[model samples]
Target: MRDADPDLFVAVAHACLLGESPFWHPRERALYWCDIPGHRLQRFEPAGGALAHWDFDTDVASCAPQLDGRLLLAMRDGLWRFDPASGERRLAAKPPYDPAKERFNDGKCDPQGRFWVGTIYEPRDAAAATLHCLTREGLKRKAGGVTVANGLAWSPDGATMYWTDTKAHTIYAFDFEPHAGELSRQRVFAQFAPRAEGQPLDDYGGRPDGAAVDTEGCYWVAMFEGQRVLRLSPAGEVLREVLLPVRCATMPCFGGDDLKTLYITTAREKRPAAELAAQALAGCVLGLRVDVPGLPVNVVHV
Candidate 1:
C-alpha cells in the first residue's frame, strides 16, 4: 500500500477508542461513532473541532440517525431507540440470541428506512451470531448467519445488500428485495488476500471490519489486522489504499459539508506495549479528503 499524504489528513480527535461505526448526520453536520469496548457514543462536529460524548451502561456497536430526530442504536444485547437530545434510551426489542456473551456488531439502515444489524460473540465464538432486519412495523427477521459481521451497506439502487464477516475477510452480496426485506442469491463479492505477515488463519478467512460505499459504488473497507482501508470497485478490484498510522483502524465514513472528507475511526484493543508505542495515535480519529463525494446516508424511520 502507498503512504497517504499527511497534509490531506489531520488528526481530529485524540480519543482512545476501540472506534467503529462512523456515520455522518447531515442535518447536524456532525460525525457519530462508538468506542465499542469503551461503551460510549461520541459525536464530533468537525467544523470547529468540538466533540460531545455519551457513555452507555452497555457496549454500543453501532448507530443510525432517525428521521424523527432520534437515533437508532444497536447495543450489546438489543435494539434501542435513543433520544440523544433528551438523553432517553428505550428498548425497542431484543434479538433471540441476546443471551450472555453475545452482542451486536456492525450495522446500518437501508435506503427504504429499514434497519439491519448483526451480532457476534463477546469472546470470539466463530459462529455465534446472525443478521437481522428491523422493520417499521416492529418486526425483526433473521436475515442470515454471520461470524463477526462488521461492515453493512447497500447498493445505489437498493437492489443489493452488501455485508462483511470480519473474520472471513470477505464481502458478500445478496439479492435484496427492499420492499419485503428478503435476501437471496448469496455470492462472494470480494475477498482479502492474506498480508505478507504470517498471522494465524481462521475459519471464515479474512479480516474486513467497518466499511462505507461511495456514490460510484466503490467500497472503502477497513482491514483491521491489515492496517489499511482499501477502496475497491464494485467488481472487487483494488482501486486505492488509504494507510493508517495505526494497525487497528476500524471504520471509515464520508462527512464534511461537501461530503468529500473521509473520517476514519481506529482501535487500541489488544495491542502490545511496543506496538502501541510505535502507533501512539492508535485510537485517534483520522480524516482525509478524497476526490469524490459520498452518497447521502439514509436516516432511520422511527
Candidate 2:
C-alpha cells in the first residue's frame, strides 16, 4: 500500500534567496535560519508570530547556539562569534584565499563541542573543497577533500555522522567517535536521482542541500531542485516524502515547543525571472507538523 499524502503545514512568505541552516533556539521559542544570496539571518517565533532579521555584509552559511546564549556563525569570511542581542561580531577564523573563486558554505556544530565547516568553489571553478573541524582550543583539523559541502547532522547516539556534497548527489556517513572528533569507514548513506524520480529537475544536478536528524535517528533531507524533503531510516530507506511548493528546498530543522515541527528553507539562486515568478515561494521558509521530534541542538563548546 502507498503512504498517505503529505500535507502543507505552513506557507511562509517573504523568504530571501538560498534559505538555509535552520537552527532552533528553545529558550527563545524561535527558529533561526539564513539566506545566503541575500546575506541575511532570520528568526521566527511561532508562539508570538514574531519575525526578525539581520542583514550581513557577507554570505552567512550557517549558525549554532553558543553556550553563553549568543550565536556562533559561519560567514563568508570564516567563523565568527555573533551577539544577536548587541550586534557585535568577533572573527574566529579567516578563510584562505583564491579570492574570487572560494567561499564558505554549509556547516554545523557536532556533539563533541567542535564546529565542522566546509567551503565551496565559485560557479566557474572545478576545484574541490575540504571540511575542517574547529575546536575551542583554537586548533583546526582538516578532514580532507569535499566538494559542494552542504548538509550536516549527527546520529542520535553521537556514534555516526552524516554530511553531503550537493554537486555529487550523495550523502556520506562516517563512524563517528564524537568524543574524539574522529571519523572512519566513510560510506554512502543515501542518494538522489537527477530529478524527482519521474519529474524533470528544475535545476541542474539534483542533489541534497541540508539535512537534520531526529531523536528516533531518522534523517530528513532537503532536495534542491527536487521540490521535496525526504525522510529516511538509518539504513537509507524512505519513510516519508514531503512535497514543497518550491523546487529548491535547501534545509530542514525541528523547532517549536515540542520540537516536532519541521521547518525548511529553500533557495532561488540561478533562477530566471520566469522560473522565479512560477515559484514565488522558492526561497521561503516552510514548516510542517510531524509525529517525531528532533534531537536537541548541539551546543558550541566555547
Candidate 3:
C-alpha cells in the first residue's frame, strides 16, 4: 500500500559529494553520516537543528557509534576508531584488499554489537568486493561475489539478514543465526530490471543502495538514481514507494526521539550539470515523518 501523499523536508544543508551511511545515536540524540568522495563525516541534531562536520584524510565510507565515545569508521584504508571530540583516529583493522581497487561502503552494527561493513570495487569490472564483520576476535570476510556491496540491514528480530549488490540490481536475504553470527540460505529477496540500452533516464527505476529495516520488518531501501525509496514487505513485496527530490537516493535511516523520522542522504558528485541544476537538493539530507518507528541503533561492542 503506497501513500498517495508524499512530503519531505531538507533536514541538513551540507552539500556532500556522495552522502551515505546514515545512523541515529540514541544516547546523543543525533544523526551521523558520511560523504565518501568528500572525505567528510557529519552529525546533525534535529532537536537543536545544529549541524557539525569533520574532514578526513581518506574516504569515510560508513560509521557506527561505540559504547564509549569513539566511533567505528570504515574508510578506504581500513576500519578506524575515531574520537569525534579529539579528532584522533586509531587504526582498528587494515584493509584486506588493495585500497586502490576497493574500499568500504555501506555498513552498520548488528543487534548483537558486531560491526558489519561492505566494500565497493571502484573499477566496476567484476565482483571483487566483499562484506566483512568485526568482532572481539578481529575483522573477517563474511561474504563475496558482489561488485558494489550495499543495503546491509538485519530484520527486526535479527533472524534474517539483507544485502544488496547495486551493480546487479538485486537484494539478497539470508537466514541469520543471531547468536552465532552465521548466515545461511542466501536467496534473492528482490530483483529489478536494469536500464535498457539507450533508455531514457526517467524510465530507469534505478539500482538498490543503502537500506534499513523498520520495526515491522519491512526493508526500506534507497533507489540510487531512481529518485525514490522502496518499502518492501518481508516477502519482498513493494508496499510503498517514496519519491525523493533528488536524482541519487543513497541511503535511508530512521531517526528522531520516536524513531519515526526517515532521513535520506543523496548524491551529487559526477552528476550531469543539468540534473544537478534541476535537483538543487541533490547532495542534501532529507527527512520525512513516518508512522512506524525504527529499531534503536546497536552500538559497536569494542
Candidate maximizing TM-score: 3
Compare candidates 1 and 2 on lDDT and give the better one.
Answer: 2
Query: Which of the two candidates, 2 or 3, achieves a greater TM-score against the reference?
Result: 3
The predicted structure with the larger lDDT, 1 or 3, is 3
**In model 3, what is the error at residue 271, expressed in angstroms?**
0.3
Candidate 3: misplaced stretches above 4 Å? Answer: 1-6
Model 1 agreement with the true structure over 190-301: per-residue lDDT tens digits: 9876554565422212368888888888888888866678898988898987766777778888998888988889888887787788777788888888888777788887
With candidate 1 superimposed using the best TM-score fit, by how many Å does residue 20's alpha carbon deviate from the native?
A: 0.8
lDDT of 2 by residue, 232-278 (tens): 89998999888777767888998888988888888888877877897
lDDT of candidate 3 at residue 256, scale 0 to 100: 91
Sorted by TM-score, highest first, which candidate order results? 3, 1, 2
Clashes of each: 3, 0, 0
Q: Provide TM-scores for the models.
A: 0.92, 0.92, 0.97
Stretches > 4 Å off in candidate 2: 1-6, 97-99, 123-127, 195-199, 202-205
**lDDT tens digits, residues 1-302, model 3?**
12223578898987899999999998889999999999999999888989999998889999999989799999999999999999999999999999988899888999899999999999999999899999899998999999999999999889999999999999999999988699999999999999899988788899999998899999999999888999999999999998887879999999998999999999999999999988898999999999999778889995
